[model samples]
Target: MFKGLKPIQYAGREVWPLIEGGKGVSATNHASSGAWAAAGGIGTVSAVNADSYDEDGNVIPQVYEGRTRTDRHQELIDYAIEGAVAQVERAHEIAGGKGAININVLWEMGGAEAVLQGVLERTKGKVAGVTCGAGMPYRLSEIAKQYGVYYLPIVSSGRAFRALWKRAYHKVPELLGAVVYEDPWLAGGHNGLSNAEDPTKPEDPFPRVKQLREMMRKEGISDDIPIVMAGGVWFLRDWNDWIDNDDLGKIAFQYGTRPLLTKESPIPDIWKDELTKIEEGDVLLHKFSPTGFYSSAVKNPFLRSLQGRSERQIPFSTEKAGEHTHQLDVGVKGKNFWVAAGDLLRAREWDGQGFTTALKTPDNTLVFVTPEERAMIRKDQADCMGCLSHCAFSSWKDHDNYSTGRLADPRSFCIQKSLQNIAHGADPHENLMFAGHAAYNFKTDPFYSNGFVPSVKELVDRILTGD
Candidate 1:
C-alpha cells in the first residue's frame, strides 16, 4: 500500500509539494511548467538559456554575432535574462494563480548572478523561488533575500548542505525554501559528484537524505522545510516508505526525466520518441563536461565518440624520463614528443586507422584524431561564447584574463553548442542527450504503453494515485 501525500503550505499558499524538474536549453519552458503549476504542483522554468519569442509569436533563435568570446558571453547573458523573464511572465499567466512558479539556474554558469538579478528585477511577483546547483552557491541566500523569494540549493550529500548552511544560508533561514538531494550517480545533466565520491559505485539515497535531515534539525531548521528528492524517481508506489516517514521529514518528489514524455513537454518530437527506446544501462555517468563536472547522458554515438577519443589518448613527455624512452614520429610533427615503446606502436596503429592528427591535452597527453575531426574541434573551440564560468574544452574562463591558462582539451566538446543543437531539431544520435538513470523506465512502465502520452494534468493526477 502507498502512503498518500498531503498538500503543504508553500509561498503563502496551499499546494501540492510535487515539483517539475527545471530542464535547461529550452527543454522545460512556459508551456510544460505552466501546465504543471496549473495542476496545483510547483512548476519550474529553466533560466538556463530559455527561449524567447519574436513579435509573430515564433521562437527566436539565439545567435551570437560578437567577434570575441567575451563579447559573445555578454550576449548570452542578455539572451538568458530576456528569455527567462518572458518564460516567467507567460507561466504566471497560464498558472492563473494556482501553484507557485520557480526558476532554476546553475551557479557555475557564466554571469549567473547577473542573470538572476536581471530576471528577478523584471518579474517581481511571478517567481516564488530560485533553484540553483552544479556548484556551491554561498551567495544564493543573499540573492534570494534581495528579491524576497525563496532559495533551494541542490546538493548530493549531507556534507554539502552543511557547508552551505554554515557559510551563508543560516542567516536567511526564513527564505530557505527546501534542500534538493540530487543523486549524483543517477541524476541527469551536470551531477554533483564530488572527488571523494566514486562514480562507479552508486550509493543509496535513503541514508544520505536521513543524514541531511538530521543535520538540518541540528541547525534549527524546521521540519517543514522539505528535502526534495530528485533523480531516479519514477513511481510513488516504489517510494511508499519514504513518504510520511519521520526519519526523512517532509519529503517531496521532483521528476527530472519522466516529465519529458508529457504532451506539454517542449522537447523535439525526435527526442520524445527516443525516450521510449531507452534500455537498461543506456544512460552513462561520465566526466567529459567542459565545466570539469561529471554529467549523465545517453550513451549514444556522440558520447561514445568522446570515449573513443579518450581511449586513443597516450601520455607524452617533453624530455625522456622513466618509460618515456621512445621518440614518437607518427601523428605529431614535433621531435620533442617522447612516449613508451608500447604506446608508440599503439599511436602508429591509431594513425594507420585514419586518426592521423594528434592534439595535445592539458594533462600532458595527446589524443589522436582525423584531420577532419581536428578541424571541427578547433572550430568549435574558436566559436565558444563562454557559457560556463570556466570551460575545459576551449580554455575560456569568464574572469581573470579570460583563459583557464591550460591547453584546451580535445577530449571534451563544446557543451553550449551540443545542447543548443539537441534542444532544437538536431539528430538525437549525434548530440548530447541528457537523461536520468531511471529514464529506461519509459520502456517498461505500463503507463507509457501504446504510445499514450499524457497531458500535464493527467500525469500529475496519475502520479497522485501513487502510480
Candidate 2:
C-alpha cells in the first residue's frame, strides 16, 4: 500500500509536490526543466554555467579568450547570465502556464551575485523563483525580492536555517517559497557537511528534517511552508510515513539523481548509460573538490587517479629535523628537501616506478606523479577561469588580489573544465560525474527494465503512483 501525493499551492498555482533538482554545467537545461514543469511539477533550471544557443540553434561553446584569471572570470559571468536567461525564457515558454519554473545557482561560484542579478534582470516575468546553496547566501532573499520572485535556500540542518532567518530571511518572509533540506551525506555534487558532522556515520533524514520544522516553528514560520526533501530520494513509497505527518509539517519531494535518466535529461547518452550500471557503494563521498567541499561521484578512473595521487604523498621539510632525518634523493631536484626514512624509501619506490615528479600541496606535503601527470596538472591549473570563489586547485581567489595566499594544491582539479567537457559528450570515465547515493536504484528499479528510459512526463506520472 502507498500514499498518493496531492497538489500543493506554489507560486499562487496548484502543482504537484514533486520538483526536479538543478544540476550544473548544462546538466539541467530547458528541455528537461521545461518538460518537468509541463508535467505539473516545479522544474529548476541550473544557472551554473548553463548553455546558450547560436542563431542557427547550435549550443555556443564557451571558450575563454581572456589571458588573466580575472578577465576570464568576467567572461564566465557574462556567459552564465546569458545562458541562464535563455534557459529560463525557453523553460517558461515550454511550460506554457502549467507549472512553475525556478533557477538554481551556487552561492560559492565566482560572481554568483552578479550572474544572479543579471539573469533576474533579463528574465523578469519568466522565472518564478530562485534556489541557492553551497554557501550561506544571505542576500538571496533580497535579490529575489528585487525581482519579485520567491527564494528557496538549500540547507542541510536546522541550525543553518535558523542562522539565515536571524540574519536576513526574516525581513522578507512572504516570498520564501520553500526550504530545501538536502541530505549532505546522500546528496550528489557539493555537500553541506559542517565540521560538527562526521562523514562516515550517516544519520536518518527523518529526524533531521523534523528538527528543521521544530526550529521553523520557533521562528513563527507557518507550517504551510513546505520543506522540500532532497537527496537520496528514489521510490516515493519509501517515504510514505513522511507524507501527512504532523510533526514534519508540509512536505515536498525533490529528485536530483533519478531525473538524469529521463529522455529529456540533457546529460550525454554515455552518462545516461553509466547511471544504469551503478551498484551500491559504487558512488563515493570524498573531499577533492576545488571548492574545499565534500562531494560524491562515481569511483571511476578519473576519481581513482586523484585517490592514488593522494595516497602517494609524504610530508617534507626544508631542513632535517627529528622526524625528517633523511634527505630525499628522488623526485625532487632540490637538495634541501628532507623526509622521514620510511618516506624516503617510499619516494624511491615511486620514482623507480616512473612517478618521477613530485608536486607540493598547500598542507606542506608532496605528492608523487608521473611526468605526464604533472604536466596535465600544471596545464589545468593554468587554464583556470576562477569558477569558484576560492579554488584550492589553482589557488585562484575571486577577490582580494585574486589569490588564496597558499600554494596551489595538486589534489584537486579544475571543476569547470571537467564539468563542461562531460556535459558536451566527453567520456564519463575520464571526467567528473556527480550523482546522489540513491543512484544505485537505477539498476534495480523494475520500471527501468530492459534498458527502457521514460520521458519526463512518463517519469512524473509514474512517480505519482508511488513507484
Model 2 poorest 10 in a row by lDDT: 1-10
**Residue-wise C-alpha lDDT for candidate 1, range 1-467, written one tens digit per residue:** 24668988889998897999999889899999999999999999999999999999898999999999999999999999999999999999999999989999999998899999999999999999999999999999999999999999999999999999999999999999999999998899999998898999999999999999999999999999999999998899888899889999999989889889999998999999999999999999999999899999999999999999999999999989999999999998879999999999999999999999999999999999999999999999999998999899999989989999999999999998898899898999899999999999899989999998999999999888888
Q: Candidate 1: where is the Cα deviation over 4 Å?
A: none
10 residues in a row with least lDDT, candidate 1: 1-10
Q: Cα RMSDs of all predictions?
A: 1.0, 0.9
Poorly placed runs, candidate 2 (over 4 Å): 1-4
TM-score of 1: 0.99
Q: Assess candidate 1 and give its lDDT.
A: 0.94
Clashes of each: 0, 0
The residue-by-residue lDDT of candidate 2 on 153-268, one tens digit each, is 99999999999999999999999999999999999999999999999999999999999999999999999999999999888898999999999999999999988999999999
Residue 23 CA error for candidate 2 (Å)?
0.5
